[model samples]
Target chain A: MATEAKRTRKNAQSGIFAVFREQEAAIRRFVRRISPSSSDVDDIAQETILRALQAEREREISQPKAYLYMIARNVVRDAMDKKSRSVIDFIEDFAPESVSSHEPLIEDQVDGRQRMLLFWEAVATLPEQCQQVFVLKKVYGYSHAEISRKLGVSVSTTEKHVAAGLRRCSDFLDRRAAESGLNETRRRSAGKGE
Target chain B: MTRPEALSADAPDLTSEAAAWLAQLETGRLSSRDLAAFREWIQRSPRHYAEIHRLAELSREVNILAGMAEPLKAAAQRRRAVQRLWSIPVLGWGSLGLVATCALAFTLLAGMPDPAPAVPEPVFLVTPVGETREVALEDGSTVKLNTDSRMEVAFIKGRRNIYLEKGEAFFNVAHDAGRPFTVYAGDRSVTAVGTAFSVRWTDRELVVTVSEGKVAYGEAPARAAPSQASDAGKVMPASSAPVSSPRTMLGPGHRLEVSPLNRAELVERLPENVLSRELAWRSGFLDFQDAPLSEVVSEMQRYTAQEIVIADAELADLRFGGVFRIGQTDAFFEALELSFGVNVEQTDDNKLILKSVN
Candidate 1:
C-alpha cells in the first residue's frame, strides 16, 4: 500500500511540474509585471510553482493556470512585505556604499526629469474631474471611499475616472516615447525599460 | 513582429481594458471570479500581456513621482485656477486667442504667491468620540487621529510639528532629511525623520509605539527646562539640543511607556501579534486577549460617551477574550452577561452598571 501511495505521489508531482513548465514563461512575465525588483522575479516564480505543487497534492487544482497565477500574486505580496522590512533595516544600519550605488547617474536623472515633465503634461490633458480623482487616488494614496466622500461623488465614478486617467496618460507617454525614438533605444538597452 | 501590427489595430481598446483591470486590482477587493477572468483574459493573447505590462510600468512610475505630491498638487490647483479664470466673463478678454490667454495667465500667475511649498496657517484637526479621521498633510505625511483626539498641525520651512493635546494618533512621517517631524505630547516629545509610529497621551502617562522605522523619544528640551529658559537656549540650540534626559531609540515592535507621576520608563519589545492587537484600533476594532473585565471596560469606555461602572469587584476581575468593534457598547454588554455570569443594569442617569449574577 505504501508503494502504491508513493507511485501516485510521484505521478502527481510530474503532472504538476508538466503544467508548471508549460506556463513558466507566462508566469515569469506576470511576476515581472508585478514585482518591483527584477532579481526577485525568478525566485518568486519558483516559489509559486512549489506552492502550487504542494497545494495540488492536498487536492485537485481544477484550473491549474489560474491557481498558479493566484499563488504567484500571494507570493509576490509576501515577498514585498519582507522586502519592506529589510529596507527599514538597511536604512537603520546605514551602509554608505549601498546607498550611493542606488543613486541614478546624471544622464539618467535628466532622463527621469524629462519623463516626469511629460507625465505631468499627460495629467494636464485629462478632464477636470478625472484629473482631480486621479491625483487624489494615485498621488496621495487616498482610498476610493475617501475620494468619493471628499468630492461628493460615487465610488464607481471615482474608479471610472482613475481608469480613464491611466489609459490616457499611458497612451500619451507611449506616443511621446515613440516620437523621440526613446522607446527604441530603451528596448535595445534594457529589453523592457520603463 | 506580427504582434505589433495586431496591437496597433486594437491598441486603444486593449489599453482601456488593461487600465480598467488595473483600477479594479488597485481597489484590493477583487473577487475570485474576477481573478479567474483576469487570468483568462491575459492568457488570451500576448498583446494583452504587453499592454498590461506597459500600463503597470507607468503606474509604478507615477507612484514614484507621488513623493513629489506637494508640487503635483500645486500644479493641479494652478490649472484649476486658470480654468476658473477662463470661465469668467471679463470684458475684452473673450477676443484673446489661446496664445494670448496663456500669456495673460502666466502674468496673473506671476502676481500670485508661489503656491508650491507656501507656508500656511496652522490647522487644528479633531475627531469626536466613536469616530476616527485620517488627514494628509501638505508635506505628504499622513496622521490617523483616534477617537476624541485633538491635534494641531504647524508646518514651517524646516520643521513639521504636531501638538497632540489629547487622545492617540498614528503618524506615517514622510522622508525629508531637511525637515524633521516632531510630535510634542505633554513634557515629552518624539522626533522622527521618516518613520511610522503612534503616540497616546493621557493626563498621567504617555505611550509611544513604533511600527515602522525608528523614533527618538525624549523630554522636550525647551519645555523640560522652563526655569532655565535663557540658559537652556544658550546651552542647547533648538536644532542641536543635546537632550539631558535619556533619549530612547525605538525600532519596529517597540513600545515605550513614560509616567510623569512616578518618573518611570518602561520599554517593552512586543511580539508581532501583540503589536498588531494594540494597533488594531486603527482598523475600527479593539482586540482583547484574556484581559480582565475592568481593563476591557475601561478600553471600551474610551470610544463611547456612556459610563460603565463595575458594581462587583469579582465581576470586574473575570477574564474575557474577544474582538469587538469600537463603540458597540450594547453588544459588549450582552456578551458579558451571556458568557461571564454578569448582569448589566441601566441606571436612571443612563449609566451602565455591571453586577455579578451569583
Candidate 2:
C-alpha cells in the first residue's frame, strides 16, 4: 500500500505513459534475455513499448509488465529471426560511451533498498563490448546472430560474449549479496521499493 | 524459484523456435495448412505455445503502430499524385488538379448546355473519293474539302489555324488581314493574310496552291500521314510537288506540295480556271485525265454503297481521261463503260465486279 503512493506519483506525473515508463527496463531486460547484441536493445525496447502501448490503447490491460514482456518476447523472436545474417548491421568500430543501466528504469522511491546502487555499479565495470552484447542478448533479448551482425562479429564470438558477460554479472551479484549480507527478501523488497 | 542456469539454456531453444516459426510464416499467401502447422507447433510444448502467443501479441502491436502511421503516408502520397496530374498539357483548362471525380461531378452539376458550339472542329474530317466537296465556311467564304481527305482545326486567338492533320482543304478565306488564316500541313503552315489558297495533306505528302493575292506560308512539323489527291483532280500531274521547294513567299497563282519522305517540291503555277477544278466538289463533280484507272475504281466505291473491284493490278496503272459527276456513282459507272472499255457487273451484297471489255 505504501508503494501505491509512489506508483500514483509516477503515474500522475506522466499520465497514460506511466505504464510503459515503469516497465521499459524490464521489458528491455527480457529482450536481452534473447538478444546478445546490446546496440539493438534500445530499438527493441522502444518497439516493445510502442507495441505494448498500442495493445493497451486498443484493449484495457491489467498486467502492464506482463503485457510489455510479452511484446518483448516477440521482439526477441524477430531479432533472432534476423540473426541468420552473419554480416553486421552496424559498423564494427561504433561503440556507445554510456554504460547501460538495469537500475530501475522508473524512479526509485527513497524508502527502498540501496542494493540497486551497488547492483548497477557492478554492471558498469564490464568490458564495454562484452557488456553491450550481454545486455542486448541476455537482458534485451537479441539473438547471438543479432549481436554478431550488429557488432560485426562471428556468431560464436557473440555467444562467448553473452555467456561471459552474464557469468561476470551473476558473479558480481553473488559477491555483492554475500558482502552486503542481503537475501532474496532484500532483492524483492528493493524491486518493490523502486 | 528456479536458478538462473535453467534460464540460460532456454535462450537457444527459444531462438531456434523463433527462426522456424518465421520461416514457416513467410511461405507466401497464408493458408489453412500454415495455420494447421502453426497450431501443431503450438501444441508441441507449453513453452512453444507461450512463445507463439507472445509473437502473435507482437504482430498485433506492430500493426497498430503501422496503422497510426498509415494516414500520414496516404495523405503525402495523394499530394504527390496530384502534382503529377497537373503537369499534362492537353487540359489547359487551368489548375494542376482537375481531379477525375471532381470533373465528373462538376460536369453533372453543370448540366450539359443545350447547344454546344455548332462548328464541331472534329479531330478528323474526310471527303469522298473522286469527289471534290466545296464546303462553305461560317464566313461568306468556302473551302473545297478535296477527295479522299482529312483535316483538323484548332483555334488560337485572332489566327484560325487548320492542321491539315491529314488531307487538304482549299481556302477561299474571308479577306481579313487582321487575322491571317493558316493551313498547317506537313512541316509548313501556308498562311493567307487575305487571299485564296488550296492546301492538301496526305500520309506521305502535302501541297499548297495559292490563287489571287500573295500568301505567306509557315511550315508545320512533318506528320505521319500525308495527302494523295492533287490540285487538279483529273490531270493530277504526276502527283505534282508544290510550286516552291523551300515554300518561298508565294504570289498569286503559285503552287506547293510536300512529300512526307522529302522536302517540299514545286508543283505548278495554277491557271485562272484552277479554282473551278478545285471547287468542282462544291458542284459534286470529279474530273480525271490520264489518271491511273486504279485510282478510279477505288474512287467509284465512295459515291455508291456498293464496293467496286478492279480484277487486275495493271488496270490500276492504266491512265484514263474523263469528266463526270461523282455523287450518283451508278451513272458514272455507265459513263466509264461507254468511255473506257470497262464493263461493270454486279457481285453479291454491295459488291460490283469490273472487267476490261476492250
Candidate 3:
C-alpha cells in the first residue's frame, strides 16, 4: 500500500510538471496581464504555478491549465488588493531609486511602453467592425448583449468579431516575440503544439 | 498582418471556440464539466493559452485607451443617452427610425438627454436558501447576492438603481461619474459613483459597510418632487427631493448601522481586523470576535436552513468568538457545547436550541 501510494504521488508530480512545461509561458502572460507592476508579474506567475502544484499533489486536477489560470487570476487579485493598501510600497516599487536588485527599472519601463505600442498597432490593424466590437466589449467593459445592441449586431456576431480581434493581436505579438528572440522558453514550446 | 485574416494560419475555429469560452466564463455560470474541457483545450496547445492571455492584455489595453481617447468616452455617453431615449414610453414606433439613426451616430455625437427617467418595471434577482450568486448588471457593475436575498435592478440613462427587498448583498459598482449607482435597502439607500460596499437589511436593522472608495448612506428619498411625478404609480428617482436628512459618507473600513428603534444612524470606523470579520461573508467564512450568542445565531441563520435559538435568555448574552465555515453549523454547535459548557437540543423541525448545562 505504501509503494502504491508513493507511485501515485510520483505520477501526480510528473503530471503537474508536464503542465508547467506546457503552459508556463501562457500562465506567465496571464499573470502579467492582470498585474499592475511588471516586476510582480514573474513572482505572481511562479506563485500561481507553485500553488497549483501543491493543490494537485493533494487531489486530482482533471483540468490543469484551467486550474492554473484560476490560480493566476486569484494571485493577481490578492496582489492588487494588497497594493491598494500599501500606497507607499506601491510608489517605491515604481521609483528607480528603490531598486536593490540587478534588474534595471528603465528596461522594464521601455519594455512596457514598447508592448503597449505593439498592442495598439495590432488593434488598429483589426477590421473596423471587429475593432469597435473589441473596444466596446473589452475596453468599455460592456456585456455581449450590450455590445450587440449598441452595434446593431447579433450577440454571436459580436463574439465572432471579438474572437477575430483577439486572434490577430495574439498572433502579431507571438510572432514579434519570436522574431526578437526575447522568449527562448516560448520558442521551445512552439514546436510542442504540433 | 494589416489585413488581420493573414496574421495566423491557426484555425479560426479554435480562436472562436476560445472566445466563446471567454464569454461563457465571464458570465460566472460555467459548469464544472465546461471548466475541465476548457482546461483540456487550453493545454492542447501553447497557442491556445497565448490567445487567452492576449485577450486579457487586449482588454486591459482597451481600458487604458478608453481613458486616453476622447471619442471612446463620447461613444459610451451616447450609448447611455440612446438607452435612456429608447426607454421612454412616449417615443413610440414612429421614433424607431430616429432612434436607430441616433444609435448609429453614437460615435459622432458627444452628449444629449441630461435628465434621467423614472424607474421602469424592475427585473427581480433572487437567491434561495444556501445559494449565493454573483450577478453582472448591464452596466459594468456586479452584485454578489448572499443567501436568501432578493433585489430589484433598474438600469436607465441617468442612474443605476438596485432595491434590496430583503437580505444582504455586496455591490462592486463600476466607476461611472456621470451616473451614480444606488442600493436601497428598506428606508436607507447607499449611493456611490465608484466603490465597493455591502448592504444588509434584516428585521432588526439596516447596515451599510464600505470596503473600497466612498459611499453616502442615508434614508431613502422620502418623497419625490411634485413636478417629477408624471405618473402616480411609477417609481420616481429617490433623489428627487434632497431633503436634509442625516447622511453619512463612509470611506473604506467605515460602517453605518441603523436600527428601527434607534432613529440615529450609528457610523463607526472599525479597525482592519474587525472590519474584515464583519465582511467575512464575502468569503465563505464567518469570523466572530467576541460576538454575543444571540448575534451569532442571527448571522448563522442567514446561511443555514436550521434555526438556532437560545432557550435561556441568559445564554443569549454569552459572548463567543471563533471562525466557522458558513456551510458547517453542526461543527459550530459541537464546539460551543464542548468548550462553553452549553447543552444543544436539536429538534426534528430544523430547530437547534441552546440551554445552560445541567
Candidate 4:
C-alpha cells in the first residue's frame, strides 16, 4: 500500500512524465530487440520504465540503462510465469495431440507455445501507423471517432488503417503457416507413429 | 501445400473486404444494398463466414488488450531522468556529480510548490428490494436507483465514472465538455456528455435506453456487436463503418439490448410514448402491455420477497396488460383472475402459483 501511494504520487509529477515521453521511442525499440514479439514490446517497455522510476525514487541510479535492462529482464520472467499458467487455454484448440499421449507430453507443448508466440509476433510486423491504429482500436478500446481525434486523423483514415492492420496481420500469420508446413507434417507423422 | 488450407488463398482479399463490412457494421447504418451484398458474400462460401468469425475473435482480443491499458498508461508515463544527465559527457566528474545533485533537488522541489486536487473515493449506493432511492452527485447530476440496484460513483481528475454493479438506475447527467461521464455495466460502457439515460443489468445482459441526448454505448476495444436496427427507425448512410457489438451510440428514444449468451444485439428507436410506458417505474408505476405472465412475475419479484410461479407452462405465456401502482399486487391478481380466468393459489411459504382454470 505504501509503495502504491508512492507510485501514485510520483505519477502525478509532470517532470517524470515529460522525460518518459522523450525517451519512449528509444525504450520501445530497446524492448523490441529482446521481446518475443513486437506485440509485447510496448508492454515490457512500460513495465521496465515504471520499475525504473520506482527505483530512482528509492535511491540514486548511476547507470539508468543498466537499471532499465534489469527491470525488463524481471518483467519478462514474470510474464513467462504468468503465460505458462494460461498457456493450456491458448493451446487447447491447436494441440489435440496431448490427448492421445500416455507420457507427460512436454515436448509437444514446446512447439505449441512457439506457434502461439509466432502468431502474436506476426501482429508486431504490421506497419507502425497501422499497428498504432490497431492497438488503439483493439487494445486501448478507442472508437474510430476517438482514435481519429487522438491521432489527428479523419474517421475514414482511421477505418482504413484498421482494415490495413487486419489484412496485414492475417496475411503474416498465413504466410507463417504456409512456411511452417513441415511442422504439420511432423505432427501428423508423430500421431501416426503413436 | 498438401494439407487443406486453414484459410483460402484469397483469405487476405476476403478479410480486407470483411474488414470493410465490419467497419460498415459499426456505423449502425446498413443499407439494404450493403446488407444484401454481405449476405451474398457470406453465402458464396463457408470461407467468408470463417473470415468474419476470425475478425470477431480478433476484435475480442482487442477488448482484452483494452482491459490492460490502464496499467500500461500509468507505467508508460514514468521515464528515467538519467538519459538527460548521462548524455552530457562534457562535464567533469565533480561537475557531473554537482549536476546530478541539482537535478535531484529540482525534482524534489518541483512537487513542493502546489498542492494537487483531492480525488474523492468512490461512493457505493444500494437500494433494497421494493425500495427506490434518488441521490444528487457533486456535479449536480441526479441518479434514481431502482429496486434492488447497486452502483458506485467516482469523480476523478478528468472523468466521472459510475459502475453499475447490479439492477438498474436512471441518470440525469450534468454536461461537462471537459470531462466525460461513463457508466460501466458488465463488459459494456455507456458514455454520455450530457444525457438522461437508464442502464439495466440483469442476468449478464445490458439494456441501455436513452431518453434525452445522444450517448455512446459499446464494449471495450470496439469488440461490441453491431446494432440490429437504426435509430428512430431512420437509417443513416450505409457508407459509414459498422459499429461492432457491445459498442454503439444511441440517440434520444433509442434503446440497445445486448445478450452475451447468444451474442445478439438489438438497437431500435422507440416512440416517446412507448419509451415512457416501458420506463414507468420512474414515476412509481408498473405498466405492462400484453406482457407474459412470467415477465410480469419477474417484475413483481423485484418489488417484494414473494415468489410467483406459473403451475402450467401454458399459463406462463398467457399475456396480461394493465397499469397498476407498484405495491398493489393484490389488485393485479384480482384483475388477472377476473379477466384472464386464471386461478391464483397462494402457498404458506409466500409462493403465488398461477394455474389455468379447466
Candidate 5:
C-alpha cells in the first residue's frame, strides 16, 4: 500500500509538469500583456506555473487554463510591487532636482490631447443608440441595470450594445493608427525627394 | 510582404473578438466557465495575445479621458456633426463645448491655459430624410430632432429660443431659472423654464407633447414692430413682445394638437406606454396599434424616399398594428405580404402600390 501511494504521487507530479510545459508560452504572453514594462516576464511566468502546479497538488483544478492565467496575473502583480519598491528606494537616494515634479511633462500633455482626440473619433463611428449606451455606462459610470432602466432597454440588450461599441471603437482606432503611420512614411519619402 | 498582407486581412476580426472578451471581463459578472472559455480563446494563436494587449492599452487610455466625462458624453450625442467635420481625417476639433471642457480639465490637472469664451451665434441645424440628429447646446440643454427636421437655435442675453421651421423636435431643457426656454412652431409656441417636451409642425396642424415638467403652449406673440426691420426673419430680441396672450398649461403625458386654419385646439392625456410609442421615432422605431393602413403607410413614407399608395380604396381602412423599424421599408413590405395578404408592386418612378391579394 505504501509503494502504491508513492507511485500515485509520482504520477501526479509528472502530470502537472506536462500540463505546465504545454502552457508555458501562454503564461509568458499573459504576463507580458499585463506588465509590458517588466523585464522579468519569463521568470514571473515560470514562477506562476510552478505555483499553479503546487496548488493543483493540494486540490483539483477543474479549469487548468483559467487557473494558470489567474496565477500569472498574481505573479505579475507581485513582481510589479517589488519593482516599484526598488524604484522608490532609487528616488529616495536622489537630490531634489532629480525628483520629478507634480506637474505633468509636456509630452504627457500632448499625449493626453491625442488620447482625447482618438477617443472622440472612435466613439463617433458608433450608431446613435450604441453611442448613448457606451457613454452612459463608461463615461457617466452608470451600472448596467441603471442604464437599462434609464434607456428603457433590456439588460441583455445593453450588454450587447456595450460589447458592440467596444469592438467598433477598437477597430476604428486601429485603422486610424495604420493610416497615419502610412501617411508619415509617405511624407518622409517626399521630403527626401525635396 | 505576402505574410504581413495575409495577417492584416484577418487582423480586424481577431481584434473585434478580443474587444468583446474585454467588454465581458469588464461586466464583473463572468462565470468560471466563461473565464475558461476566454483562456481557451487566448491560447489559439499569438495574434490573440497581441490583439488583447492592444485593446487593453486602448481601453486604459480611454479611461484616462473619462475625467472629462461631460464633454465626452456631449461628443457622443452629437456624433453625426463630429463625423462630418472629422471626415477629413485631419485633427480639427470643431465643437466649442468639447474644446472648452478639455481645456478646463487640462487646467485642473496640468495648470494649462483656459480656452477663449465662446460667442453665441444663431445655429441652423437640418436633418435629411430617414435621419435624426441630437445636438447639445451651450446651456446644457439637449435637442433631438426627428426625421426630416429643421430648426434654428439662438440664445442671447436673457432668453433661449428655438425656431422649429419644419418637422418635429424634442427638447430636454436644463433647469435655468433665469432664462425661459421657448420653442416656436408655426403659429404656436411652447415655453418652459425647465421641462422636456416635443413640438411637431406640419402645413395643416401643430402638435405639442409634454413628457416632463409643465409647459405653457399658446399662439406665438406677434413679431417685433417693423421699426426693427433689420432683424426681420432673424431672431427677435427679448423686448419684442409686450402683449399678454392666453396660454394653456400642459402637464406630463399631455398632448396638444392645434389646427391653425380652423383655430381649434385639443388636449389629451396619454398613458406612459402610449407616450413612449408616440416618441419612439427618437430611437428609430415606430409603434402602432390597430391603426388604419393609410395612416401607417403615410407615416412610413416620411422615412423613405419611395411613395406608398393604396391601389384599392377598400384596403385604406384596413387595421394594421405592429412595431417596426423606421427606415426598413423592405422588411415592412415583406411582413405585409406574408401576414396581411397584401401584394406590393414597385413602379418605375420609385413608388410602392399596395393591393389586396384576393
Candidate 6:
C-alpha cells in the first residue's frame, strides 16, 4: 500500500516532468510569438508552465496534453492581460517559429526560410478576424480569458474563433502548397482512395 | 462563418484560397465567424496544420525583416528629411513636434535607451498648454507631465516629495535607498522607495496608486480647495495637525484615495496590476476596470477634440474594462457596441453618445 502510494506520487511527478519537457519548446514558441519583448520570452515561458500546473491542480485531467497546452496558453494571456498587450496590431513582426518551433515538418523540405515566408504572407493576409485570433492566440501573447477581455468577447468565443481561424488558415496553406507545385489535394485524395 | 470547401474528386484552387485566408490572417483582420470557420477547416486536415505552421513560420520571418528594416527605414527618412532641411530650413520649422517625434523614433529603432539616457531627472516637471519643459533631477528620476498638469519636487530630510497640483502625470521614479519618495495629492501622499508609479488628481479628489514594488503612503493634507464667492464646494476642513494621524502603509494592490472632506485613506484593495491602467497614458493606451464611461470619455476628450457623451444616466455609470489605443476612439466605441449590443451615434454637436437598444 505504501509502495502504491509512492508509485502514484512518482507517476504524478514524472508526468509533470514529461509535460514540461514536451511543452517547454512549444510554450516558449507561444511566448515568443506573443511577447513584444524578446527578453521576456523565457520568463513568460516559465510563467506559462507554472500557471499550467496551477490550473491542472484545480481540474480533473482528461487529456493532459490538450489541458496542459490550454493552461500554457492561458498563462501567456494572463501575463499579457497584466501587462495589457492584448491588442494585436497588423504590422507586428514576429516569425511564427520565433513564436515556437514545435510546428509540423514539411515532407518536402525546400529553402526553409522561403517556404515559411510564402506561407506567412498567406496567413498574414487571412481575414482580419482570423488574423487577430491567430495573432492573439499565437503571437501578441493572450490567453482566451485575456483575449476575450481585450476583444470584449467570451472565452468560448475566443476559442471558437481561434479554432475556426486555424482551420481556414490551414486550408489556405494547402492551397498555397498546391500553388507552389505540391498537389496536396491529390495526395490527400490518394491517401483517402487507398 | 464561411463553410469549408468540400474535397472534390479533383482538387480546386486550394492554394489561392489558402493564400487569401493566410493573407487575411496576416493582416490581422477577419470576422469572428470567419475566424471560427477557419479554425474548423484547419482541424479537418493534417495538411492544414502543416500549412499553418509553415505560414506562421513565414510571418515570423517577415516580422523580423520588417523589425530590422524599421530602423533603417526610419533613419533613412530622418536623413532625407535632414538633407531636405539643409536645402530648405523653412520646411524644418513646420515640423514643430518633430523633436519629440524624432527622439521617440530613435528610441524604438535602437531598442530601449541606455540606463543613463533613460534615467530621467529626479525633479518633477510640469508643462503648461502649448509649452514643453524637460527637467534634470538630482537622483535621476525623469517625470513627463502632459500639458496643464502641475508637479513640484520637495525634499524634506529623508523623504523625496512630489505634489501633483493638477491634471495627469507619468512618473518613472529612479530606485533609491535611504531616501523615500512620495507624491502628495489632496489628503494622500503616494510614497515609493523604488520602482515606478503614477498618481492622478482632479479638483474634487485625489488618487495615488503604485505600479511596482510597494509604496509607502500617507494621505496628502486633504484640505478644502480655497472656495470662491460663487459655487458652494463640498469639502471638510482638515486640521493642520492631520500629519499627526498615523501613517498608512499601501502595498501594490491597494488604491489610496482621500477627498478634501476625507483624509487620504486606503479606499479599495484594487489589483496590484492597477498600474497597468494608471501608467497606460504614457503608452497612449487607456485601460479601465469597471471604470465609468463618462470618465473614460472625459479622459479621451483630454487628448482629442472628439468628446464622448453618455446619453443614459445608467449607461454613464456602466463600467468598462479594456485597453483603448490612444486616439482610437472609434475602435473603442465599436468594442463597446459589440459588447453591449448598443447603438453608438454621433450627435450633431460632435459628441459620441451610447444609447440603449431594446
Per DockQ, the best of the predicted structures is 1
Model 5 agreement with the true structure over B1-358: per-residue lDDT tens digits: 1114466576747756776776665555679898778777766765565455445444544543333223333444356655554433223212224432322211211221244122244567677787765666777777777778877676654567777778898888888978788887755678888998999876547899998999988777654532233336543323335323537999999999987689699999997667877887665456665678899898887788888999978678776655454455565776566445478999999889999754
Interface RMSD of each: 17.1, 30.0, 18.2, 20.4, 18.5, 17.3
DockQ (Cα-based) for each candidate? 0.12, 0.01, 0.07, 0.07, 0.09, 0.02
> How much TM-score does chain B earn in each model?
0.62, 0.50, 0.60, 0.59, 0.64, 0.52
Residues A72-185, candidate 2, lDDT per residue (tens digit)?
656765555454221111111111223111234222332111232232333344566765654444333445566677779986666556445444544555555554443442
Of the two candidates 1 and 3, the one with more favorable lDDT, higher being better, is: 1
Q: Write the per-residue lDDT of candidate 2 for residues B33-103, one digit (tens) a residue.
A: 86677656656555554333333222222221110111111222323332443343212212223222322
Output the worst ten-in-a-row residue range by lDDT, candidate 5 chain A. Answer: A185-194
Winner on TM-score between 1 and 4 is: 1
- Model 1: CAPRI class: incorrect
The fnat of each candidate, in order, is 0.27, 0.00, 0.14, 0.18, 0.22, 0.00
Cα shift from native, residue B70, model 2 (Å): 81
Residues B1-358 of candidate 1 have per-residue lDDT tens digits of 1125456676648878878876776666679898788777766665565556555545655653332232233445545543543353221212223322322211211122345454345467778887765655666677777888876675666767776778999888889988888887766788899998999986647899999999988877653322233323321113334433537899999999987688599999988668877887765456676677789988888888988899977656566655444544565776565434468999999898998653
Query: All candidates' lDDT scores?
Result: 0.64, 0.48, 0.60, 0.58, 0.62, 0.49
- Model 6 lDDT per residue over B1-358, tens place: 0123553323354433444455455434579998777767656554444444444433333332121111111222333332433342221222333333322312212222244322223233455442223333345554555545766555434445665667666565667777666666644566666765567776656666655567666535553432223323422222222232337666655666766464434457764245444654553345565576678767666655656667766566555555444444555676566443346898898877777532
Candidate 2 lands at a TM-score of 0.35
Q: Which sequence of candidate numbers ranks them by TM-score, best first?
A: 5, 1, 3, 6, 4, 2
Lowest summed lDDT over 10 consecutive residues: which window, candidate 4 chain B? B73-82
- Badly placed stretches (over 4 Å) of model 2 are A1-194, B1-140, B147-150, B221-247, B272-275, B298-307, B313-319, B349-351
Candidate 2, overall lDDT? 0.48
**What would the per-residue lDDT of candidate 4 be over residues B1-358, giving only the tens digit for each residue?**
2213444454537778877766555434468897788667756655555455455433333332321221112111111111222243211211222332322211211121133354344467778787665565666567777788877675665667776778899888888978778887766788888988999987677889999999987764331322222212322212122222335779999998988598588999987557876677664456666577789888877877778888977667666555544454665776556445568889998898888643
Candidate 1 deviant stretches above 4 angstroms: A1-194, B1-120, B223-246
User: For model 5, how does the per-residue alpha-carbon lDDT over A1-194 read when each residue is reduced to its tens digit?
Assistant: 55643454467655555555666665565455444244667787778778987898798764444456556655655553454334333222321332222322223433343345456557767898888887666544455676788789997778888778877876675565556654322232222121
